[model samples]
Target: MDTTQTAVKLILDRWEASMHNYDVLLQSLSDDQLQKEASPGKNRGVYLLGHLIAVHDSMFPLLNFGEKQYPELTKIFIESPDKAVAELPSVQELRTIWSKQRTSLKEKVDQLKAEDWFGRHTAVSEEDFAKEPHRNKLNIILTRTTHLAYHTGQMIYLK
Candidate 1:
């Protein structure tokens, strides 16, 4: 309708497209294939999947949606590199978590008004937000959309 609404729609559309592309790519791979490295000595498909989930889970707190659903994943998937942790969640387990997390996140995101996207996220101080208005909740979506696309490109090598 308005310029702000159009802009928000564009950003969200890109995020959803990136997510859809990732889902299709991941679904095409089998468990055995996911376990293999995306490239020699690089992260595996499963590792990338977990890493994405961990990053997205953090958005809950950053966006003031709530506490992270899987804070433990931050240690295994974000703090440590692939294979750094002796034990990792099964591929199926990660898939289930990913689905649930995305579903809940979508519900919350859908409830937001267009103006809400321009509000300061929890991570930014009010003083700073006043000075730097671009650092808003919608910016997180833009950044994470590109982040997802980046990993999705890497995972393509696993196919």
Candidate 2:
């Protein structure tokens, strides 16, 4: 394949591996431990998990695949700080959503053509995208992979 195709493939491969590691880390947690803070003032495992889910949910809309699967997640996980909101979704509920959303997102990503990975995402205007093509769907995957890795580290503190 061409350079773009090769690069996109590598990105997807890394993304899949990163997600697998995240899943293993999450599966290791107990429900009781999920409620504890990662650090004194930091977010809990449940909150971080929800936040990651919400961010991934946004990928559908952001990458032009479809609307977000969990808009409500934005309010509790993205918009509000941990414990700042009176209540958040139950850990079981978020885990269900996370599993479903990950499968859906993987299917969507798998369906993309090599060229599609370099196409501008939903956030960019046509004119701007034409000028700044580097900000593409693959960029989001790379950024969000780093994000998941960061939170995965925090999750260890909760254990």
Candidate 3:
């Protein structure tokens, strides 16, 4: 494979591995366990899960893939702090959404060519992209992978 292909493969592989690790960690916890905070006064397991989903849902629009599948999640999970919302989707419901959203994102992302990964995402203006080429579609995956891993680490405290 050429350098671009190799780079894309490596980023995608790491992103997938991060997602898998998070899935395994979340699966190990029961629904009741997810209701507890990961640490005292910190975000709950369920809140973290919803927050991750909300962030990932925004990626569709940012990456120019499509509109967000769960725009409502942004208000609850992203805009509001953990207990600020009066209610949240059940843990099981969040799990199902996570699974479906991740699968859909993977399908769309996997279909992109190597060059497509290097192109600017929708969030970047053309003039800015020319000046700052590093802000590309692949960078979103890299950053979001790190974001996932960080929250996954926090969720470990729940166990």
Over all chains combined, what TM-score does candidate 3 have? 0.98
The parts of candidate 1 lying over 4 Å away from their true place are none
- Per candidate, the number of residue pairs that clash is 0, 0, 0
- Cα lDDT tens digits, model 1, 72-94, are 99999999999999999999999
Ranking by TM-score: 3, 1, 2
Task: List lDDT for all candidates, in order.
Answer: 0.93, 0.92, 0.95
For 1-159, candidate 2 gives per-residue lDDT tens digits of 989899999999999999999999899999899999999988989999999999999999999889999998899889898888988889999889999999999999999999989888999998998899888899999999899889988998877
Candidate 1 C-alpha RMSD relative to the actual structure = 0.7
* CA deviation > 4 Å runs, candidate 3: none
